[model samples]
Structures are given as C-alpha cells and as structure tokens.
Target: MTRLSRWLGTAGALALAGLATPALAAGTQAGTTITNTVTVNYQVGGVAQNAQTASDTFTVDRKINVTVAEVGNATIVVSPGQSQAVLTYSVTNLSNATLDFALTTAQQTGGAGAHSNTDNFDTTNAKIYVDTNGNGVWDAGDTLVTYLDELAADGTKTVFVLSDIPLGRATNDVAVVTLTATGREGGGAGAMGAALVQTAGANTSAMDTVFADGAGATDAARDAAFSARDDYTVSAAALTVTKVSKIISDPVNGTTNPKMIPGATVEYCITVANAAGGAAANNVALTDVLPTTTTYLSSFGILMNGTVTGAACNADGAAGGTFASGAVSGTLASVAAGAARTMLFRVTIN
Candidate 1:
C-alpha cells in the first residue's frame, strides 16, 4: 500500500491523542522548533487505505524584553568627599531567550529625581559594574562591565553605579543617575553581543526579533531597552570656624581691659560650629601656628572643648591639648548639628 505525504506551509489542525503540554515560566524558549503533524485514516471502496500525513514546522521568534528597577525605595545617603558611592539596581531578563544587555548611564541636570528631590549636583567618575557574587552591594570581586553577558531568560542580576562625591558639595544636594539596558544578541563567550535589529517586513523560516520591552524612565516602549533612576543625597557636615582674640593684660596695664601692646597676654579662641539639619562633625582637629614674634605659654593653658561665653571662649575647658613646633593643636571629639565646640589658648606678645 502507498502512503500520501504533504508539507503544510502554515498552521493547521493536528491529530494527537493525549499530548502533554509542558509548563514553562517564560513560555516556549526562543529558537525552539514547533511542529505539528496530522495523520488521516480512511477506507476507499471498503478497502483499508494507507495513512496519509501532513506536517507544519516553524521556529519561535525572539521576544526582547527587560526590566530595570532600583533596588531600594529610598535615596542613597552619601557624604561630601565620599569615594566609590554606590547606587544599586536589578536588571531582569523577561525575554524568551538568553541575551546580552548593553548598560549605559546618564546624569539628570536640574530635574526632579526618582525620589522627587531636585537634582543639583553631578557625581564624578561614574562607572558601571555587575555584581558578580549575586550580592547587591558593589565589591572588589565585582567586575566592571559595560554590558551583561549571556543572562538567561527570567534571570535577574544586580548592577551598581559607583561614583565619587565632590569635596565641596552642600548638604541635601542630590545627584540623579539613570541606568539603561538595551537588549542584544547572545552567542559569543567572554565578549559583548552585537546590537539587535528588529525584523522589519515579514516572518521568515528563521527566528525573527520582536521588541516587547515596556517604557522606562529614559526609553520608549518597544525599544528593546529599559531604564531606571536612582539618586545620591548628600548628608554632610556644614562646618564653620571662627577665631577671636582678646588681650588679658599688658606689662604696664594689669588685667583692667588691657591694650594690644608689647609683652601683653592675649587669648585666642577657635570655634567650630555645625549647621542645623546637617550631619555631625567628628574628630575635628584645630591647629594654630604661633607667629615668630609671639611665644606660646609653656604651661598647659591650652583649653579644648571650651564653653562659649558672649562671643568668646571661656577658659573652663579641659587642658588636654599640646603645644609643640610653634603650633597649638587640639582635637574636638564631635560637634553635633546646631552645636559648636571651642578651643582656647593664650599667648604673649614678644
């Protein structure tokens, strides 16, 4: 008996009994070959005829999708002069196939950031890195990558943007950074994949590229890219230092409102004040170099953490500082916000 066979160019009905459908998290993988075959059993003139079969086969198209979201809900707290400050984000591949993603960053200028704060400053030396250890924080083991390599479908990766805060940034200053990931082809090992081009005209026998990514902070819909924004907020100490000097006595005029004459005892007061709503200043070192004509008193008269009395530092402080190499130096443990600490010492005119 002869059998009839035919090829189906398009989708057709198939006859399969009790076929089991596999459960998939990301649906059928891209580049998967799906084929359907139908078998026909019939009788011609009361005689059994050979079974006929027709089959249709096609490859699954590539659906490019990704999501980029900031890891935390709050803005990253940073301080002036801080180095290697990190802003974390997670990039998840929602595509049906493994892919490489090209990562890029942008600095928002004078606009509201993701946290609704006005962006005022730009962080310096910004760079992108992948969290190689699956940890959200950036570490020495993390690789500095310009793009993610061969991330599987439904896989999530932590990415970090490290930057340097300038030394003179003010408190409450915000720097907004945007991260964008564009989907690319994946096949090469240890290297970035080529840029993806969406299939324009018609479906082919091979897998076609379809962009299914949603709109993000900086990208448009169906662009095969996603973006997210995160900000760095400065929580720094605003310190102010003020120095005042007063004469205590002279060689001729005793302690009765003495004048600034030769051989006069003069007192110096140094105040360090931190602004309100700012971070505390710690380990403040106050130093004063004595002039060539003036001489530092030999006794332990240098007072640290003194009390401020009417625009002048009083001598009711601990005498724990040192005077050497023609300089008077002391350390203030801390100066809290809206608070001040003073260092007072006395010297004599030559």
Candidate 2:
C-alpha cells in the first residue's frame, strides 16, 4: 500500500472513533432516542483541531405500516349447489422501505347473523393469486404466488382470493371469506433472535439486522393488516323431458294398435318440462334426427308448440316451425318454471 493511502485510511478511522461512544454501540429500536456528535481528527500540515458534541437526542420513529382494502364489496349471484366466487384486494406497502408479506384467509369468525356468516356455506378449492395481466379483473391466466414479494413503500398490488361454494346450499345462503396479510422473512420480519434481513444465504453481518425505529427502545417485529371479504348466493331448478309415439295409419295394422308396417305414418312427440321452483331455462333448443328404418317427410319436418294430446291429428302444426331436412334443429323460447313445451314430427316406416 502507498504511504499516503495508509495514512489517510488510519486518519479516517480515528475520526469516526473520536465520535464513537456508548450510543454508537447501542442497538436501534422503536420509539427511542438517539444522539450524535461529530469530532474531527486530522492535521493540516501537522496542526490540531477539536469539535463540540451535541448531548440533545432525537426521537426514533417506527412507521412500518401497510393498508389492505377490498377492491370492492363483491357479492356473487349464483345458482344453489353452484360455483366459485373470486374477490379482489389491494395490498399497499405504506412503509418507507421494502417488505414481504404472507397472505392467509379465514371464514367468518364473527358472531351469529353477521355479514361474515359462513354457516350456510364454506369455500372449496380456496387459493390466492396475483394479477399479472394488468387488468383489474382476475384473468384465467395469472401468476400464482404464496406471498406478496418485495413490495416497495407506497406501492400496491392487485391480488385475488378464489374459492368455490358447495352445492346444496340453500337460497339466499351467504358465506363470507376474509383475507389477511402478515410480515414474513427476508426483510422486516425475519426469524427470531435477530431481525437481520438475509438477502442470499442467511443472516451474517450485524448490518443486515432490521430495527423498528432503527435503534434503542425495542426491536419488536410487527405485522400489518389489510383485510377484505365477499359472499355468494344460490338457487336451483329441476327440468324433465318426455317422448311419446302414435301411429297414424299402417297398410297392414289399419290404424288401430298399428304394428311397424311399411308405408305406415308415425308421429313422435318430444316434450320438455321445468318444475316451478326457480328461474326459467334459457337458450332452450331441441335437436334430433329420424331413427333408422324411417324417412322424415321432406315437407312436414317439425311441429313446434306447447300442447299436444292423444293419437289424433286434431291439432295441426299451428306453431310448427320451418322444416330443415331430415335433421331437426332450432332454438325455442325460454321455458319458464312450471311451463312445458312439445314438438312433433312425422316419419314414414321404410
């Protein structure tokens, strides 16, 4: 080492040592006092000097805080014995430094009849994920992680809590799910004994230790709370379908208890019914093809209506829809609860 470089290094160390005392060796903590004084140890052509020390102390501050808020109050309208509800939350790091947080969710712990009631139904397949698509909505494709990693102070992340509601839940049954976040290791909340935040392998030097106030009342580790909730409702419906047949005329059976004879005209009735219990069935449609050994009449393809009775052709295709070859397919009006529909088509025995 050069002679000048060695002398300068020694002088700088001596200067810092001149100001060093008990407080310099003391630990940093929350709500504490700190005092500092600078003393110069140097020579200008071998001259001496000294500086005054301040005995007045400054108060240390513990502002490791965060705020958690539900993106919005979410209430899913669903069918009984139904589906999943995904709720969004915003977790913001309000601290001055970076922090890592562990996330967790709990069912309603509130007393009876509370909005957080989970008695009616609890969630299934519960999970949490991050929003990577930049959209506020949780897309099917998004990054899934267990913790909120390295959030900068004043920064926020969009997170989703996804869960499925069990079937068999009664109508108007509501279940609330709550989400909570706590401090984790690698930063402010490392393992016990020391608050040193390890960057790579593990804690090594004293410089890695974290202080609530950065020195002297106590090095207490703290967690932040940002919680939110959402609920779901269910409703159910029952639908039934029936098919019947009638023989119009048979060259052999003579139209009474007609047998499957060639040239015999057959009428097939397809009916659908929905019991009066829930909302109407939507986008209802029926599709079918003529069975083997039978030929669908090119002209009389399908008869669409809500009513049909015994073997009589008493009712024509009043509501019969446009025919489309041997294959029958078309949309029908939504069937309301307690309502029924019937469609008939004629086919000749091959």
Candidate 3:
C-alpha cells in the first residue's frame, strides 16, 4: 500500500477508466486517499525538450457495512440450577476497509416486540468473549478481549456469549442474550489491519497522531453502519433418580430362581435418570441407604451406565460403591438428558 500527501482539490478533479489488461492491486482500503503524479516530455520550438509533472488524488469508496448473527439460532440448553450457559455468534467485516469491533452484551427481560421470546428473567454476569481458539467450546485458556483486532472485508470471527443463569429455573424456562458490536478504526495489530498504536510518520508532530486501534475517529462504523446486534435463547436442566431391589441369591435355592428369604443376597439397583425437556446432566451421583434388616456386601454389584444393556459393567471406574454403618451407596459419573443410568449394590438379609 502507498500513502502520499497532496494539496486539496475539488471532487471532479479525479477520473477513472476501464482497464483492458490485468494490473497489480495495491491492496488499498476503502475511504483511503491515493495520490498519483504523471510527467510528460515535449519539444518546444523544435529546439529543446522539456518535461512537466502533473498530479491528482482520489479516495477509495467501497461499501461500508457489518453483520452480527447468532450461530445456529438454536436454543441453548441449561440444566436445572445450572449457573452458566454459552451462546455463540459471528461478526463479519462487510466493508472494504479493515475495522476493529468492541463487544457488549444485554440480557432480555421478557417484553413485547423483538424481545417477546424473553421469559421475564435475565442471565446474570453476562459477558462476550472472542473464541480465540476457533473452537466452539468455551475454555479457561481463551482470553477475554475488549475488542477484536481489525477485521478485513468479508472476514468473520466467532465469539462466545457466556453468562451465569439465574438459579431455580424450571424445565423449559427461557431467557434471551443479546450481543452488540461497534466498529473501531482499522489498522490494529493483525495481518489485515493496523497496529494498535500506529507508527510515527514523516514529521511526527506536524499532524495529529494516528490514535490507537479502538481510539481512532473511525472507531464507529461508516454512517449508521456503526453498530450491529444479534441474540440467542437459553433453557434449563432437570434430573431425577429411581431405585429397585431384587433377590439375586438365596441359601435354599442356591442360584436358581433366587428367593427373598433370610440369608438371600439382594441386589439393589439405583437409577439416576436425565428426564426430557432439560439440558444434559453433569457429575451425577446416586445415594441409597440400605434397609436395617439387610447387610451390605463389599463390591457386590455392577454399574450399567446410561443404558441397561450393550454398555460394559463398572470396569472403567465410571461407577462405584461405598458403605458406612448400615447404608449402601453407588453413583454414575454423569447422565445426559433423555438418558438413564443404573448401578447395583448387594445386600444380604441379616
């Protein structure tokens, strides 16, 4: 890219013509001023050859626009009593010039108009973060930046809209999260833009300094194009637990057709299920107190995770048991929504 200084001129001073052949592009951005000079040689009075130089300047003018859109536009599932959920969005630099963008978030409290889908509640401590890793999942390693590095025209960057949800939310509960962005002056630190603080030019103090990326006068978009907004919805997570007991062994019948008699070994199955209409359950655990009339045996049962069949028994440490006094307990690490998990513990009649 080339930058040249020139005296001011009227709008009609510049002209353009169609190129019949290919040419090299200087990669100049829209709203940029470019000045050019031409020299012509002529013979005056058929005696001597003289050369004169003429110059003209023009400004690049490409469409300046931006788009903010929710990713997938699907409802984000939240677990009952869950504290946080992550929504996603993307912002594309629609203008020919590079521009930085500052991010902000506003939660919706149910109302009429575009906010009609809101549920009269808002996510607390909401924030927006650039997905620096480019992965959709939010992680501790990702940095929270105040603004995006200058983005090139048609370039898109992903962001995570994260927030702590209000507790005690019922199943199917809904909340809205809106993300807003304002464009910043281009030339921030990145391949496509400017340095945050621009380099000093000829006669540094002769003219105003090129401000930091976000502090530039063009920080706002061109005209009304300055800002863009988009939003996503969140739901709740629910979980339930169930238990069943059956006779697995009896002294009278050996192992065939076990009877619920004294000295019979009883296998108690506890199921912690993720019911429908809620987000996936995490770190699920089941607790059962054994009947006083029975004695729990050490390491007696198998852990069937998520499903009753096809899945292997508790060999992977995903399920386990513990006993204290007369109580018997077992647990599965987790159960996803619409899924069920069962674990077994053995007890013998006292």
Against the true structure, whose lDDT is highest?
A: 1
Give the per-residue lDDT digits (tens) of candidate 2, residues 1-350: 24444455555554674677333222234344444333435656777656422232344443455556677654666665444467788877665456676777777643332244444667687788888786888888777767787776567888888777776665466766666755443544332122323233544332232333221111123433455565554544456878777888888878777876899888777776777866566667787776778888656667775564543333444455545565666555777777776777788899
Candidate 1: worst-modelled 10 consecutive residues by lDDT: 9-18
Candidate 2 regions off by >4 Å?
A: 1-55, 63-67, 78-85, 94-97, 106-119, 164-175, 185-226, 235-237, 242-269, 274-299, 304-341, 346-350
TM-score-wise, the better of 1 and 2 is 1
**Whole-model lDDT per candidate:** 0.87, 0.60, 0.59
- lDDT of model number 2: 0.60
Of 2 and 3, the candidate ahead on TM-score is 3
Task: Check candidate 3 and list the clashing pairs.
Answer: 78-236, 78-237, 79-237, 80-237, 185-219, 187-194, 188-194
The TM-score values for the models, in the order shown, are 0.86, 0.51, 0.52
Residue-pair clashes per prediction, in order, are 0, 8, 7
lDDT of 1 by residue, 1-350 (tens): 12124343233423231235554555568998877765778999999899876766778899989999999878999989999999999999999999999999999998889998999999999999999987667899899999999999999999999999999988899999999999889558778888899999989999999998889998899999999999999998999899998888999989987889989988888999899998999999988888998989776378888777667677887877888899999999999998888988889899
Of the two candidates 2 and 3, the one with more favorable lDDT, higher being better, is 2
Worst 10-residue lDDT window, candidate 3: 1-10
Task: Look at candidate 2 and give me any clashing residue pairs.
Answer: 28-215, 28-216, 29-215, 29-216, 68-226, 79-235, 80-235, 81-167
